[model samples]
Target: MTYKQEQLSEEKVFKDPVHRYVHVRDRVIWDLIATPEFQRLRRIKQLGTTNLTFHGAEHSRFNHSLGVYEIVRRIISVFEDRPHWNKEERLLCLCAALLHDLGHGPFSHSFEKVFKLDHEIFTQKIITGDTEINRVLEKVEKGFSQKVADVIAKTYQDKLVVSLISSQIDADRMDYLIRDAYFTGVSYGHFDMERIMRVMRPMEDQVVIKSTGMHAVEDYIMSRYQMYWQVYFHPVTRSAEVILSKILHRAKDLFEADDFTFKLEPTHFLSFFRGDVRLEEYLKLDESIVYYYFQAWQDEDDVILKDLCERFMNRRLFKYVEFNPNLQMKDWMELYTLFQQADINPEYYLVVDSSSDLPYDFYRPGEEEERLPIHLLMPDRSLKELSRHSDIVEAISGKKRTDHKLYFPKDRIEALTDQSLKKKIITILYGQGEVEDVR
Candidate 1:
């Protein structure tokens, strides 16, 4: 039995702040988005804790999926008559780009950290499992769903298809860098995307930028760097994550001791706490359901649960300062002991935040996860690795930057009943004086 491709009478469009309008021409793509599993993405925030820092970033992955599909569609439109560009690969690329993040769970990073679940696994399930997305893919062909999954999994033998969605400069990154920047209301996303698209040429196995468009590529690389530092790695976001991780830890502890009762459903959380989670149960969990529990736990008998929930809900983010992991180990221990003495839980109050990213890594022999380095098409029709041709990419290539921040609740510290313990903790956290930014 074969499913017929059904199109809406009038083309359906989603009004997006980033892409303006995402057009759905194919019935399969439209049906995939309408599925309950896909619709759940609308409830999950794209930037998670970033909403507390940038109020405008209240968008969701559903918006991003559409944006990615549009970008890939535009790319495919440009390469329709070009050599080495297969028209048959069009739908596969579009579907892969649109569903690249389909597996992302609620509060993605925090949920992953607590449950030890990888979103990529869920993404494959959504595409191949007994879901509407699978039904839609099967409409294209019997094994079309697996092909789509392969593209996202980066195991598709067609390097061209894989490069379109998973490469360093693929539609996924191209869309998110711009979408995230636009929603966060930052200027760093102002790269010449039109120019980049214009210069993109499909090769035998990959997409290469025209040498004439080298500057645009450089601008893109720099924009990504700035966005990472300015938005993606913001200390405030990490602070919120730290608080959330501790909340999950405390909740698990309480559940184990039977020391607390949940007023709402923690169905998804129970399996995670017990180290066993089924895929179907995992699918039922979303950010809204998790947040509902947080709201209800606000009035719980456990003081720790109540405080953490209040902190997360009210945007009372933890205060952060530069930290030296080795040098501060002693100070950290002392601070923990001091918190115990002051009746404050050091386990929740003290946290170390760290983030690292490789701006532009060039291909090297025998490296784990060898990146397919970006290439520039020379006028002579030869390809050159971007780092070899661009001084800027060369300078930043293989260079990884890391930031460490010590996070604590400054508000509670200032109100400490034990003056001596407070003084010690203050000295350890902020170095021997009244903390300046104690909010």
Candidate 2:
């Protein structure tokens, strides 16, 4: 089948909070979103368990997909009549943006960790395989679906289209940074997006902000830096993630041992436990279904399963404290023993959480996962690498920062019937003082 862009009789608009209105002019994009595969995003929260910490973060990836499409639409508007910006690439870029996250399942991060599934691969399949998305893409032209897939895969021959959706600073990142910040009510992600869009110019191989707009680029980099530390890497979110991961591990262990009796048998999880997940089964799983199981599993006889479900649903997040990996191995071992003595399963109750990110990186030749360093197009038509010209960017480039925490249930330990064991655990975990709130 060939792919052709078909216009809808009446253009549809999604009332978006960030972009105001996400307009869909093409029928293909509309049908793609309406497909059950894409609609599943409505059930998958954009920030995962971050909603546990930030109640307002209840927005879904469905919101983000629209936001990214709107951003790309704006960028494409800028690219019109510009050098190296091919107008023909418009539909391809839009398709890639809309379908980029079609593969993500419910509670994406935790599911990915437990099942070892890569959303990217599933995304490719949805676009190129036998599905409504593929059928829509094939309507454009033969091989058009592949072209869109190529853009998403970052292998499209057109560098401009590839860069528009998947660069150091692309539409996806631009949307999520601002959208996540808005929903999470964090100030760190407020950047001049309009200014960035105005300055963006299509280059031979990438997009570059004009020299005069260097300040806007600096602001964007800084916004990302602050957002990472302040929101994306928040410890409370990680604590929930740690608990979620342990729940899956313990459930899988119990299923294998045949010691667990689930009110609702783990049908959806069987393939994952066997290390083989069909796309259909994967697509059927969403946050609502998971929450339904969590509700049911709260009554399971297995202590760990029941406890974890209650913890996740009620937002009884694990308490965390600063940990230094190099110096804390012995302490971690001791904590594990203390957890055993306290009758808390060390495997499910004790966890180490670490998060690291580079705010920005300078071009280092031949580095794997090398980001296309931002450039400023000067008045004289010369290109300059961003860090060379921006003092703030230069100050932060290549600096990777990491945070680590040791997580446990503080309330449970505090309520233990065995006073002696509780005291020993508390002393070993926090060293004579009550555990401080981790926020």
Candidate 3:
């Protein structure tokens, strides 16, 4: 048998908390997992700064990637005998599921936001670039690496294959929802995944759910909504993320400043600060490396850098209050000016973080971010969009919810000797009794 057709003599199983067990029998998958690029995920936290809020939420991307692969494995097994499900695409789907999150950097979202990087682009690069992952994929077949990349990029010729990984109810989402919930000790993400998987039917261009499983799909959607508010977007997690982003911003600014000299050279971050990070450099800077820098920068000469690093390392997260940009523009301007007068850099200390979510939405062409609506296969060989038939889903469908919070160092403001300035800031911030000390 060719390398592409090779299978393990015995299946390798990973005992997983969320999926029970992840079984691997394909040689290509086993080899790919052994690659350094894949192993690097072990050091990268799945939830980033969320560990500070939920101590149990310390799982890694490695855990999530395997969970996704297992889910897709079970899904493809069901699809193998169904119409419109290509057996040739089985390994391709599994590969994409396992490696989908390959390019996530340390503190993934915050690093991407502060550095203007996209993990999806990096994922494609890792699969196609000069790397072990690319090498293993190339061994699968000529041009196979590009095929996997295309699947992840949502540009593959087979829309059915793409939907298995990228669609609204894909394996990636299913694994993360349950996996994250399991680790974080939250009940909001619980749902009947097995029911959803059993009811999944392959179609010409996407996967569909049988009418009998509509309630299961609804439960999954609602679970996702609750998980977003209860665990994923918890205010305490956001506070830590705010501080992390600020730290990256401060470090980058210091790196750009001619007069600023780091007592210890930021070797790992130099490429990131310069905006020319190569793949090798990107993979080397995992969460442990980032934490090392944060620890060292605590002793730096720059006060802002030192302070931000200290806050992050010690979890002295900034307090936050509900903020409405439209109604509080005057107060915001005044507060910005007062913070500057008090020698507190408004840029680093005062921040507004906004988070928004669209729990579920029907397909709308040409929209900025179009979400492909979930479809349920009817009893009479018909199809209907999920929200169209379910009143529970219809009520919440297409509704976008947004939250805005103003984060600032309340302790710093309270420490100011200027009594009048302190009172003004306090009255503006705490007047509504919205001050949240996410300690």
Each model's lDDT: 0.85, 0.85, 0.93
Q: How far out, in Å, is residue 239 in model 2?
A: 1.4
State the TM-score for model 3: 0.99
Candidate 1 vs 3: which has more TM-score: 3
lDDT per residue as tens, model 2, 1-439: 2234467779899898888899988877887888877888899999888887888999999899988988998889988998888888888888899888888887787779787888888888888887877887887888988998888888889887888888778898899999999999988898899989998999888998899999988988899999888887888889889988888887788888855567789888888888888777877788888888888888888888999989988888888777887987887898788789878988888888889999898778888887888889999999999999988999999999998888899888888999888877777677623454744
Native-to-model Cα distance after best TM-score fit, residue 106 in candidate 2, in Å? 1.2
**Candidate 3 — which pairs collide?**
none
The 10-residue segment with the lowest total lDDT in model 2? 430-439
Cα lDDT for residue 72, candidate 2: 92
Best by TM-score: 3
Q: After superposition, how far is residue 149 of candidate 2 from its true place, in Å?
A: 1.8
Expressed as tens digits, the lDDT of each residue in 221-252 for candidate 3 is: 99999999988888889999999999999898
Give the TM-score (vs. native) of candidate 2: 0.96
- Runs of candidate 2 with Cα error greater than 4 angstroms are 1-5, 432-434
Pairs that collide in candidate 1 are none
Model 1 misplacement above 4 A: 1-10, 432-439
The candidate maximizing lDDT is: 3
Model 3 spans > 4 angstroms off? none
